[model samples]
Target: MTDSAASPIDRPSFGIALILVGMLAISINDMLIKQLSGGYPLHQMVFTRSAIGIAFGLVIVQFEGGWQILKTRRPGLHAFRGLLVVIANMSYFAALAVLPLADATALFFAAPLFITLMSIPVLKEKVGPFRLGAVLVGFIGVVIMQRPWASPEDLGVSRLVLVLPVVSAITYAGMQIMTRKLGMSSKPSALAVYIQTMFLLVAGLFWIFAGDGRFAEGTDNESLIFLLRAWVWPEGVDLWLFIGLGFNSAAVAYCLSAAYRSADAAIIAPFEYTGLLLAVFWGWAIWGEIPGLEVKIGIVLIMGSGLFVFLRERQRNRPLASDPPRGTGATRR
Candidate 1:
């Protein structure tokens, strides 16, 4: 986390590029996780990914400032942030196991909307009419995807299960908020390492207590089947894939942290939607999972709302000739 006080040079274009690259890495990570979720326990996959990610985090932390990076006055905040991320990851991967990739990604995009709402209380930030309207539009998109007004037959059993991704998005928003709070106090590598540590602990506990032996021979629910599935000895190929996924995860985390630190978040944040394009591409390429018409509509509404919010922020924060210094405006930091 870079200090906000020591202003960095404005580089919104470069920050946007970094965010796009990060989202691409994240999409690759999701593809690998979805591929492995078929045969492996979610916990086991998390354990493997986090174990390798911790190694990457260590190298990054060392490069940043060696052991001095570990010195933070806010261990409790880091731990809470770590817990939020662990829960977010669990909920997200669980939904990914059952839903189409594009559909899941669409729901997760609500995180930004959630962040906008959460900021009112958490950061004491004032929300003007434009942002409020964007938030409402975003939730309308969520309801469209949920389709609670539909008949029971149309709703299907998956309707209830699909809520997991929404939960994931909310928790992810909270995690992002916490990241902003701690951004000035901790190193980005330290935050990454903390979350990886929590992942290892959570996954290890799940493996020990919820291993395959505890479940019946057959399970019908896709989400549960993915969650409670027993860990197995990874074959050589799966082992290699797990290793690749860890590095991919590290790249995503570092690039995202760097992007936000480099320029105004409003400028860089819209590019995060690049993940949806990659999600659609990978979903079609790998699984032939084209989103249905209703889902496509929902995706558009959510994305459109998010883009509108970003446009409003950019306008609100635009620099004026009367403004004092280059670093004082919203666009600068």
Candidate 2:
């Protein structure tokens, strides 16, 4: 008999290994982005990340033999996925500008809640009371984090901070749904290639046009300075970090995919909240920023809701409390 290692199927050990390593890389990537955000233009970081990601995807495609492994028959659906990339990155990066990585990620963790609701309407999937309750609790967590209804002064809400991630979360949830639907027939590598290529194309065009417009329309001397030079060029070390960012992003995709192959997604899902922990630590270490109690409570509530959903989902997938699920759901990595 052929060795199990030589089989086409990935072993349980293989997938879990991929997941742990991937999460570590993703954590490092998030920390890098948080550090890089302050001095560099958020859009510039967006530009490089998408660009480098495309380059990496292209390498993957070529190795798998040209566009055959990369192209999907569904152009429109692929484009929609591409748009989600634009929206989610813009929103998350915008949030990174002011919010600590931990705080912002805590808010973004609500995607599963959104996805659970979205599945009902879009995919016509049925959700039980448990999941619904989880969603409600997640919303309460969101309200605490955002304080969206409060007066601007009371909340310190700003243009980019509050609006960006709300939309980013919705788009990210859409992206997940698209991946699931596409997974029915489409190749994951193809989907990754499409997302990367289309995202870079669109974001590059945005920088070419929108950025130039903003520069031309920039009113103050400070704004003009941003337009003229300072924002374009961060230090050399920061530029190299963008390559690490690309690898980190790729690691997240690969890790989550591998992890899911081994165990139940719901069971693994709660681990995603660990990113909040990493983000918090990074925030303090890099910026000396301490979140207020409100932020801490928000993280706890959000993380709690996610953990509940994950456990509930795992129970459903495995159909037994004693039985472990067969897929993992390690988020962001």
Candidate 3:
């Protein structure tokens, strides 16, 4: 499929609204996952959530264009994209088990910066020096949040665990770039089904290997425990929360895929910062996790740099572009 065969009209405003909604849903999903981290293993939660998500995604498929829309000439790309999402989710959620919601979210917001940098090499787009500098400032924010100079006890998190969200950000950047590529030829609902299915497959593999919790024994690492812990049957409110995750996952996948597919990524990417605000609010209200002065400064720098990049891209009228795939259409802005 070609760009002309996909969406001919780019609706950036609509994309922004969708991304805001997606970010909101994502924040709620993170809170639920964190709340359940103590009692449930990550794979089990992923399994339950994905199973439910697949059911919802299939329903979306019917509304989209039926099961036919799910057929693609790019199965390999979809598979690769799914793997990237699974990696991104596992790493970020693992960090959530050990870090404050605000802190983990702040670190993960580095995805926009990674997206900007990756655009140059991966998409063959040109980035100006000013935008490059903004990327640098964003890294400084990540460093301040990490606080390498502080001891583990002083920081209240092991430095080793700090790497997880960064890993998540990098893989997520890669995944979103693929989303842009795949979005040119696929429906958002179809893209979402691929992701949910991947999550289910990975969760099943984890169940087969580590669901017994044998590997988690004698380990005090909270992040590892979250990954390797035995699966317990969820009861009462916990079951409802798991069900909620399914709805959240389906919403997030569709909204984000549609948002990126509909506009220049630079145009809508900054809207994702909304998640940070939601995370901070949820952290304080639910877990009593408050951002320190340094964390506040770091967040400011990160968000500031990202907004600057967005403004610069808009000012230059230089949205990232991919090589045209055979057929001609309106050039993406």
Candidate 4:
């Protein structure tokens, strides 16, 4: 059997460590993006960050096994995965421009639940009644956080704006599914390069279409403004922040890929929750944002249900969260 085909049981501890590091990097990256959202367009930030990330990712690719390792037979799937990631990043960051950081992060955590549901159709995985119920409970948590019955004034933002993270989560789950399929043939660094390249291309297109800020005129909607605002040449500290985002993106992509590649997703997936705590910290420390009672309750339910789903998958010995294709050798390069 190839190294990649070897059982994940061999390096589970290392996988957990990698996931924790990835979550920390992600939390920092999110906080930085949110901080800059008021002054920068989402696509501009994505462009800057992706450009730097591609540079770093190329270096990683060289260390893994030179430029040839970047080649893949599944170009279409890679492109689709890249598109999914772009959508996920755009939706989530646009929400960050207006919503509280912790709230956005919590809502996006529903991706695990979405993955469980999507697996039934996408991966042809059978989820038993218990996991199905967990999925339902998780959605309930989502509804509670949304509080659709409340007015926009009371909730502090439009209900429509709140949906962005959920949209991001769904697309993110789809991206993970694609990653599982692609993992068999691609190295994590190569995958990161593909994603960064996509970000660069899409961001460039956004610049061509809307970077002039003409579309942002007369819009009071904060999210729309974040999306349509004109790109300004970042100066001084803002320039440094944008540069930092590139490093963070490179770290996040590679660490997460390596984490999942190293072990069973079930064993390491729960560690991904570390981001929630980091989100809470960053939110409070930087913006004085705290989760209200309703949000706290929603977070509890969503987290509980998501964890239960992972546990159930583990017990059943099914790989719903991320079942990489079988019989492929490790493409560590």
lDDT of each: 0.75, 0.61, 0.81, 0.82
Where's the lowest-lDDT run of ten residues in candidate 2? 1-10
Q: What is the TM-score of each candidate against the true structure?
A: 0.89, 0.81, 0.92, 0.93
lDDT of 1 by residue, 62-124 (tens): 897786766666677667777887888888888898788898889988888987888778766
Instruction: Score residue 88 of candidate 4 by CA lDDT.
Output: 89
Candidate 2 Cα deviation (angstroms), residue 64 = 4.7
lDDT string for model 3 (1-333, tens) is 211256454798988898899989999999999999999999999999889888998998899778888777777876787898799999999999999999999998888788778877777777778888999999999999889889877987778789999999989777766655544456777778888888999999999999999999999999999999999999999999999998988888888767866776657766878999999999999999899987898899999998888778777776543222211111100
Q: How much RMSD separates candidate 3 from the native structure? A: 3.9
In terms of lDDT, the best-performing candidate is 4
In terms of lDDT, model 1 sits at: 0.75
Residue 150, model 4: Cα distance from true site in angstroms: 0.5
Top TM-score hit: 4
How close to the true structure is residue 167 of candidate 1, measured as C-alpha lDDT? 91
Write candidate 2's Cα lDDT for 76-110 as tens digits: 76677677766786677667666677777788877
Can you write out model 4's per-residue Cα lDDT over 1-333, one digit (the tens) per residue? 112332444478887888798889989899998999988899999999999999999999898778887777777877887898899889998898898888998999999888788777877777789989998999999999999889877998988889999999999887776666555546678878988999999999999999999999998999999998999999999999999999988988888777776777778788888898899999999999999987898889999999898888888887755544431211111
Instruction: Give the C-alpha miss distance for residue 35 in model 2, angstroms.
Output: 2.3
Predict model 2's lDDT versus the native: 0.61
In model 3, the Cα lDDT at residue 69 comes to 81
Query: Which residue segments of model 2 deviate by more than 4 Å?
Result: 1-13, 62-67, 148-151, 182-188, 213-231, 261-264, 318-333
